[model samples]
Every structure is written in structure tokens, then in C-alpha cells.
Target: MNFQQRKNKILAQLASRGEVDTRELAMALDTSEITIRRDLNRLSDEGQLYRTHGGAIPVDQPPLPFEFTQKATANQSAKDNICRQAAALINDGDIIFMDCGSTVFRLCQFIKNRKIKVITNSMPVIQALQNTAVSLNIIGGEYDAARQAIHGSMAIEHIARYQAHKAFIGADGLSAKGLFAHSEKEADMALALAHHSHITYLLCDAAKINKPSYLHFAPLETVQTIITDAALGQLSYCKKKGVKVITV
Candidate 1:
């Protein structure tokens, strides 16, 4: 097929599957991987799609802050898989910081039976574990009604006052520049938690691997490990910066 024909096919795949990987697209089109990469790059530059670690996702408007209830059900399966892996990393009597992201909230289900202390700003997470044996500490801050979470200078100060064995946070997108969030306050809260914890874990689904967001919260080195449902080519870049990845 001609160059334009190849590019069109890539776009069609992204539209149908929401994402297109370089290797997979090359094999499907009977083209070299290098040619596929070039097509993806061109498409990205033209704003036709958003380039990811090993693939590209359909192009759309910039992301906005999503409501907790809305996001909790958006990618339930991937979030569940990621949460299961995160819960296995927890042990009895451990203290952890859980962010307000939906993926982090899913961890509550697996960890409810464990004897662990959780420090969080997420109202949903608090509600999820309210009947469990786990100890909970809610951060004090100005509440964000849209996000159903707490954030502000008060929340950041509260996070810094305590240290945890681990901190599990979520991101809207992950690129070579680092983790991205939709809101500055949310990013601030995540950064504070990562700083005060012994180990920071970024819990994200495959859809978030190469997405873009307005706020660049922290570099990949800010977190000690990344927990996800798919392999990310960018993991190599993160490894060189001393960040480990756990793909479930």
C-alpha cells in the first residue's frame, strides 16, 4: 500500500481498538516496524493521534478532571487487575498512602481484610474500607466536590506530617517527561505523598500508559515502582532512572 494508505489503516485501527501498537500494526499491514513507527510519528505530529510508549491512542480533546464515580467504572477490568497486584504487595501491619484515583480505590477491596493502616484524601476509599479491619486516616483539606477528594495546602501539610511504608497513587498519563495529572492540586498531593513514603507506587491501567495531561506532576524517578496491566516500552527509560515496573 502507499504511504497515505498505510497511515489511513493505522488511523482506522486506532478508531476501532482505541489504540494501535507499532509491532502489531506492522505485522497486520505486512510492513516493517520502522515504517510503522514513521507513520505513527507523522500521525502524532499532525494531531491525529497521541503517541504512547509502544503504540498510539485516538486523538481527542485534552483531558478534564473526571468525577470519581464516573471513573470508577470506566476501565473496571484493568483497574481490578492492577489493584490485585498492588494488594499482594501489602503485608499485615503495613502503613500505606492511597491516592484519590479510581485505580487506587480498587485496592481497598483486596486490602480490606488485611491489618494495615491507610492514610488517604480519597472519600471513596474511606467509604470502601469503612467496615473493614484496616485503620484509616483521612487528610484534612479543602474538599474538591468534583473529584470527591480533599486537596489544598492543608492536605499537602497533612500528608507531610506522617510517613508511610508505601504510597500508591494514580496518573492520567505516563510519558518520558514523567507522570501527568489533570489538576495541579492533585499533583501536589501526589508529590507530597511520594516524598514522605518509603516507596511510592504509581498504579495505572494500559490506557494511561502514553496519554497526555496538562500538569506534569513529577518525573518517573519520583516513584520507586510502577504497577500496570501492560508492558510499556518507556519502562526502559524509567529503569535507567532507578524506577522499577510491575506488570500484572
Candidate 2:
């Protein structure tokens, strides 16, 4: 294919699959992986996609795609509120899985003094809890620098070896349609974490409601609870589906 044609085709593939690796794109396009990497570099420089170590993610995403610093400050108040409730639900000797996000960051804010065994893929979570009393297990693999989170086959493998009494996840968009994430790696980690947990909780804010996005890691049915502010109107549906709703 010509240069323009190839770029157009790659864009379509990304929209459909959410992400594309250089080697996989090279094989599919019948070209050298070096060429695919060049295309990815160009696309990234143009603000068309997020360039990962070996792949790229669509630039337009409902998850806001904030850097870790920006995310930590985005919804501080709501995060604090939701995390308080999450910490309350977590008993003293519980085995907990903390998913990466600003909301969960708040939960980690309080977890330091606790006596819980915590498993997480968030670099910031590990940094925050490094000197704490909570026992820690860090899921390591391909790390996404912008999000400061880890995922991939290796991280998923580590997650499979652990089980948690409850999993507290940070969600981007939530609605009756599905729970959305920005990248396939995040979606995969969320899916794997949900299956390994005894109970799953998604923490989101009012802005995330009804905002449709590309990836749905797990439907509401897969989660045990959704902790959000009161402006979220779909609590009734979420509750009817057996998701323990926590709004405080």
C-alpha cells in the first residue's frame, strides 16, 4: 500500500482493536517491523496515538488519559470520600487488591497504617505504601509511564497467583452500557483482577456517567460494588444487578 493508504488502514485497525503492536502490525500489513515502528512514531508525534513500548493507543478516549499527576489531582474530594468508604469495608486482616487510579490512591493514603495484605500493579501505590505496615505484592510487567500502571501477560500471570477478599478499582466511565477504560492493557489488568477477587468495587465520579468509550473491561455484573457520588442516576440499575452500591 502507498504511504497515505497504509496510515489510513492502520488508523482503522487501531479504532477497531483499541491498540496495535509494531510486530503485529508489520505481520498484518506484510511489512518490516521497523516501518511499522516509524509509522507509530509519526502517529505519536502527531498526537494521533499514545505510543507504548511496542504499541499505540487511540488518542481520543473517554478515560481522559490523564498523566498520573493530573489524575491524582482531578477529583481529590470525591476520591477521598469513596476511598473512605472502601477503607471502612476493608477489615483489619483482609487480603485486598487495589487497582490503579486516583481514587485508589486515596485508599492507599489510609492503607499505610492498616494490617492488610495488598496486591497492586500501581507504581505510585507501591511508593505510597513502601514503608507502611501493609504487606505488599507488586505485579510487575510492561509499565505504562503516563498512567504509572503495569500490565501485560507477565503482570496478569502474577495476578493469577494471588486472590483477594475485595478488589478496589478505579474506573473512568460507567453506565448501563458498560465500564470503560482507555487502553487495552488497562482493560486486561482490570479483567484479570476482577476474576481473581472475591468481591470487586469500581470507584468513579459524577463526570464519568454516561460517557461512552471504546473498552469495557468488565460489565457491572462482574463487579461487587460501585462507589460513586450521588449525581450518578444509574445506581438503581447497578443495585438491581447485585452490585452492592456504596454512595457516601
Candidate 3:
């Protein structure tokens, strides 16, 4: 079959199965793995799909676009406490770089009409701050439907112009090994925020502590502080690394 036909077949298979492996593609197309890999790369670059380490998956799915209310309900008390403390770290009018995550969303909820400017990639954060008196700027970029955050050329271009006193990030996983995220785009964006802001704070629940997700964002030494529950069981590691650990 020709290249276009092969790509179409691969996309169809991915759409039907939600995910497909390189080996599977080779078998289905009667082609070599290298050729299939090239097709996957091309399709991914064309915004036709997303390629994982071993295989490919649907691009526009749950994580690329997230639901705020469902996520907000998962860990109510932890999220709330984290938010209140996160808000405390901020001066009344400090400009902040807040990323998408239920925890950061909780922080946005805690500040009641506070005088602050929030620059974020989450649609939920934008919605939360828009009703309140907090000044907000929503970075427009490629919207990843699964994570519900925008990251790409547009988001980076807008974020580059602003310097924030503090940046709050929510990570998918963390450990003595390093800080990691599920998406390479998100990992890159988080690193950009850490470099852009004066201080970068990572807000994670105990559930994420010491876990290594598929993608690595940055190292623990790169982060200024890590805010989590005292029960996360990795406080010792954080302390040893000179990472200020905050427990609520």
C-alpha cells in the first residue's frame, strides 16, 4: 500500500482501539517497524494522533481536556488545605503563574476577590477568576483535550512576556528520582514556568509522592518548594535535597 493509505489505516486502527502498538501496526500493514514508526511520527506531527513510547494513542481524549467538577471532588479536604496555604504564600496582589490541576483550582477558590493577577493555561482557572475580582489572563494555545491545559507555541509566547513572583504547578508524579508529568508538552511547559518565575512551587497530594510517571519534567533540585501533606512519606527525601517541604 502507499504511504497515505498506510497512514489512514493506522489512524483508523488507533481510533477504534484507543491505542495501538508498533508491533501491531507492523503486523497489520505487513511492513517493517521502522516504516510504521515514521508513519506514527508524521501523523503525530500532523496533529492526527499522539505517539507513546511503545505505541500510539488517541490525541484528543479525557486528559487533554479535563472536567473540573469531577476532579475537584476527588480529594476535597487535601485540595482545600493546599489551596488555602498556597494562597497564603501569595501576597495580596502578587502576579502568579498557576497551572491546571484540581489542587491549583482549589487555590483559586480560596482567594476571595483578592487583588492578584493570575496567568494560567487552565480553562477552569480562567472561569474561576473571571467571576471574581482577581485579574486574570488566559493563555491561548493548542488545547490538549486530555489535560484540559493549553501548551505549545502560543502559550509559551504569551507566558514569556510575564514575570511572576511565584509559580504553582501540579505534578502527575514525583520522587527522589525526579519530577515527572504524563505529557511531554506539559513537562516542557512546567519547566518553562520554573525557569520563568522567581520561585516555583509544586503542589501534589500524598498519592503522587515517590511515584515516577512516564514523562520527566525536571529535577527536584530545580523546584524551590514542594507543598504536600505530611503523610506523603517522602518528606525526608525532600529535606535531604534542600527542598523546602510544606505540610498542611
Among all candidates shown, the one with the greatest lDDT: 1
Give the lDDT of residue 89 in candidate 3: 86
Alpha-carbon shift of residue 111 in model 3 (angstroms)? 1.5
Report, for all candidates in order, the number of backbone clashes. Answer: 0, 0, 10
Per-candidate TM-score against the hidden true structure: 0.72, 0.71, 0.70
lDDT-best of 1 and 2 = 1
**Model 2 agreement with the true structure over 149-225: per-residue lDDT tens digits:** 88889999999998899998866777786688888888888888889999998888777777757787677797888
Model 1 regions more than 4 Å off: 1-66, 232-234
Candidate 1 lDDT, tens digit per residue, 74-192?
Answer: 67768878989999999999999999988897787678679999999988787667656899999998998788799999999998899999999999999778999999988998999
Candidate 2's TM-score: 0.71
TM-score: the better of candidates 1 and 3: 1
> What is the C-alpha local distance difference test score of each model?
0.83, 0.78, 0.78
True lDDT of residue 238, candidate 1: 77
User: lDDT per residue, candidate 3, 1-248, as tens digits?
Assistant: 88999988998876554556687689889999999999999988998877665566566632222255566556666766777788888888788898877687668656646888898998767755665668888888899766677989888888898899999988888888779887788777787777889999998888788888998768898788988875745567877888898888
Worst 10 residues of 3 by lDDT: 61-70
| Model 1 Cα RMSD, 1 decimal | 13.1
Q: Which rank order by TM-score, best down to worst?
A: 1, 2, 3
